[model samples]
Target: MTGVPKILMTLGAIIFVVGFLMQFIHIGRLPGDIIVKKGNTTVYFPIVTSILVSIILSAIFYFLGKFR
Candidate 1:
């Protein structure tokens, strides 16, 4: 049907927009050191590292998808 192409295009456009937004969603960012000290115990939270990992992974996915 003639409507099929139009429907598919619309869905593709929606997927593009959603994927674009996802590129900006910071899954990990620090407000501050993610731990506190009451004079004992030391801990750490990995936020910046995760952001970097996400970026690398996204880039790889983007390129692989393109080459296909």
Candidate 2:
């Protein structure tokens, strides 16, 4: 019923927030590429990672809802 959809929305929001936070809890930059130490080394790609994850999750939710 209506209650079920509300619960789904709430749960989806929580899942999204938790996933988003995972990218920031690290010791380095919030996401993006970063240079470490005095040497020349750059770690990249995580900045777009969070968005990609969120999009994938949302797509999954959307497809699942198509049957409901």
Candidate 3:
């Protein structure tokens, strides 16, 4: 295949693998993520998870570009 279809297939595979692994690995609850609780209110933020995802995506795109 060429261009968009190929890229879409690769991304779909990557997402599938990540989703499968998430069944056994709790990704959003990483230590560096933030959580706050007060009285009857609680808040959660996946800062570390977002950063990790950004880095992973950057690496994947970089390699994909190299191959192009």
Which number leads on TM-score? 3
lDDT of 1 by residue, 1-68 (tens): 99999979988996897689779985444654266556687567766766766898799779979998
Question: Model 2: runs farther than 4 Å from truth?
Answer: 27-68
Comparing 2 and 3 on TM-score, the stronger one: 3
Distance from true location, Cα of 28 in model 3, Å: 1.9
In candidate 3, what residue range of length 10 has the lowest lDDT sum? 1-10
In order of TM-score, best first, we have 3, 1, 2
- Please give, for residues 1-68, the per-residue lDDT of candidate 3 as tens digits: 46899879988998999899989988787989999999999999999999998998899889989998
How accurate locally, in lDDT, is each candidate?
0.74, 0.71, 0.91
lDDT of 2 by residue, 4-47 (tens): 99999999998898779878865334555343554575545455
> Model 1 residue 36 lDDT?
53
TM-score of each candidate structure, all chains considered together: 0.41, 0.37, 0.71
lDDT of 3 at 19: 95
- Which stretches in model 1 have alpha-carbon errors above 4 Å? 1-40
Q: For model 1, name the residue pairs that clash.
A: none
